[model samples]
Target chain A: MSLERIKIAPEMYEIMPPEYQDLVKNATYGNENRGWKDIGTSKELIEEHSLCAGCPESMAFRYILASLPAPEDTVMVGSTGCTSLVFPHVGIHNIHSLFGNQNAIATGLKRALTVRFPGRIKDVVVLAGDGATVDIGLDMTLQAWFRQEKFTTICFDNELYANTGGQESGLMQKGFVAKMAPVGKTFEKVRLPEIARESGCHYVVNCTVSKPNLIEKVIKNAIHIAREIGPTYLQLYTPCILEIGKNSMEGLQEMRDSEKPTERFAYREYISDQAKELLTEMAAKEKERKAEAKRQLASVKA
Target chain B: MSTSYQVLRGPEHFLPPAAASMGIRLPDPGQGHIHGKIVSEEEAMEAAARQFLSAKVPTIFPGPLVLWAWNEKAAHKATAVRHLYETLKASVTSTQQAMLIPMPDYRPKYPKINPEVEINPNHPNLTIWHNKIDACMFVGVHCHQANLSLKIIRGGTDCYTIAMCAQAGHEDAMLSFRDATAEKIMRLADWVKKLKGSVEPPK
Candidate 1:
């Protein structure tokens, strides 16, 4: 018998609890495969999970997962592609459903759990790949949002069916090239958040994985809104690492260096502020229209 | 000549007789406590690590850590396992031990768009083989260390172990395992390496 005692640093032990030390021991003994970087982050309070390492959107989802409250009651419905890969590694309770059926399954789960357990369950989150949400599951998603189902739906918009070897998805940007769309995708990318808003979803937000902090905040807020108000749609910009011709390291760096900064500046300096202003203007117009319609109805009745 | 192992036939092929063996009754399932509290980041880390340790077996020696981030509400654990494998460069470890044990078969009961049905029209054998592959992939990730060897009975598959290893800067184990399984022992030995700084996304 070979006896090898490894001594961990005092600082490391201070940062992590005894349970975590046991987890590392189990991992060593089990020979389980996982991304080293992600496993490292698992030591943090928030843990992110995903299907594809190459997809930027998957990485973004991971970042968002890192920011959420631990012992989360949220259930993630992963459609096919990158987001599907996150489930096993994250160590959270999750469901891997068929492609494009995340919304329907999530809707059923939310209804069932809420009905059975009542207020015990917190929220249901659907993590969809571009192909599943945009191409196949679009109809179900629309119905779910239109019905105002109580759930938080996140679309990691990577512009392709990454797991099936980078095929073009309905959400593929105009200039993007995928396996099926070798030359370029002719269809315009679907602005899913705007569609959700029009479909009568109570809340909608679009952000990229690049902004880890913001993504976390948005996820927390989205879950809250889903529970308090109704359904919430979050369109996340996730990059594809392999499909986009980059390795995992480069993909993460790209998200951190460019995606996060750009998103922060845009949301803080322009989008959110402008959105508030626009909402105010829209509310005034709606009031005027409603009053006019009431008067017209009254006059006709008279 | 009849097989010499006739005495060990039928359902009792492997297990010892209950009357003659140590019969320990497991605790009732639903009777267990259900503590549903939101864990802090620190607590979550500790819990993940502890769970990892409890689930691990030492037979394989330095198995890859399988981290599962389950979304509790969906009741869909299989998809989560698949997603974990894809993102992490991990494979499902199906073993015979898992088969003998009463593990939950979390495969979706509903109809899915089976790729094999559409891709191969003429070749029945090919379609069946492909379907088996798909089914295996779906159920494989949930297989624990003991069940890993069962995956090999089907042929042309690997039985990998799953554990949850969370430490500062130990993220490279996945890549290290991919590069060299032989180096896994050394990697585990070096688990004490501290993360250089905070794990913040780049600005």
Candidate 2:
């Protein structure tokens, strides 16, 4: 995933497709300030997604990919769902092995990467849908967190099995009438954030894709914490427009509606004392590094 | 796979070729060559057609792109795949379930297509061995997934692999078809139909 590895041969540049050229020129391979605002302006690591138009999951995917602190050294493990549909289009290396086993795979992958590159930072992330995270893969997902695996787990909680035709999922709201819940859901949505916090995650966040800056901050914080401390989880409310019978343009409104301060999906965060200390140290170090770089640039200009 | 770079100290740092374990070593990444020699699209399709018609157990391993959201021509490609399947009477063992369910609700809608068997994307070689598949073609699979699947099939079985992709062809596949458009897939089906008409089925 190093930038040196992605360099193209000079002779092959003329024959390479424009997309490849764009990737080499404009990709945020080594950019320091990676964020969601770079979506349209930069040639993103994701070439293009195959997800439905105006899908909040897609937006979250874009934000997450953009907010990765080190795209050159990140390996994402995704499970089956609407999220898998877009994995093929992402430029970074990703694995979509089995249904609901993303966390288990990421656990192993993170450990293996640690052993393989002791000096380098290789961040492993698990990205999946609500069904994969809270239902079928719950055991493995919780196991990874309990083990304190050094990686980030982000659930694109669409509330139902939207990829499998809108079946009621564990993350679905109580009384929601979905395919498997013809008489309305019998149980309340699973409290995964609280479970993750208790299960040993150093950092936890519950939010939505309605705000890109918040998404960037949480994702970056989660990755940073996971790299130094322990496991981190982010549960994003990405509503399924198709399953909810909302038009393509209404996904954002649905997300905004669900993320009201009093609503279940409202923004929340839990950080351990160790994680807090590490973040404060990291912030001060980053500021010092920026100041040093500024001083060096001024000297060159002088 | 972990990459280890060697630096040559000089006026300018010279970085040697990537040394990565468990990664495909592409001699020339831009060139079509990988596991086998690069061949033209027509040549690759011709070989694929011949293999399907002549093999005792020929299988079409359709990926999600055939029936799902690959691109605008995914529906057309699926139709061509169906025609090719009918012409060769090949058994279908799809890897679409690697990341998806093969139920009626999750099935492709344009022209409903179904596989004879669904194999896990991670261990496709198991299906190849169990079914005694001699020749298989990967249609509409993602490049990265196809690369891993091809290596697995190559490692454990003697099945000849073909990669039919819309992007640059895979280097791991024995026969690779690049820029595999809907019309090209139909042409391959037509070629297989002609070849099948001229030959007797293998027992």
Please give the clash total of every predicted structure, in order.
62, 0
Give model 2's TM-score versus the native structure: 0.63
**What TM-score goes with each of the models?**
0.48, 0.63
Question: DockQ of candidates 1 onward, in order?
Answer: 0.03, 0.03
Error of 1 at A298 (Å): 62
- Taking the tens digit of each residue's C-alpha lDDT, what string does model 2 give over B1-203? 33232211111212212212324333232233323554455665667777676666777776656644234466677667666666565322232111111111111211112223454355666567666777778877777777766766765677777777778776566666777777877788778766754554455
The candidate 2 chain B region of ten consecutive residues with least summed lDDT is: B96-105
**Interface RMSDs of all predictions?**
17.8, 16.5
| Candidate topping TM-score | 2
> Per-model C-alpha lDDT, please?
0.46, 0.75
lDDT per residue for candidate 2 within A71-184, as digits (tens), equals 989999999999888886677888895998999999889999999999999999999998899999999999999899999999999999997788999999999997656898
Worst 10 residues of 2 chain A by lDDT: A8-17
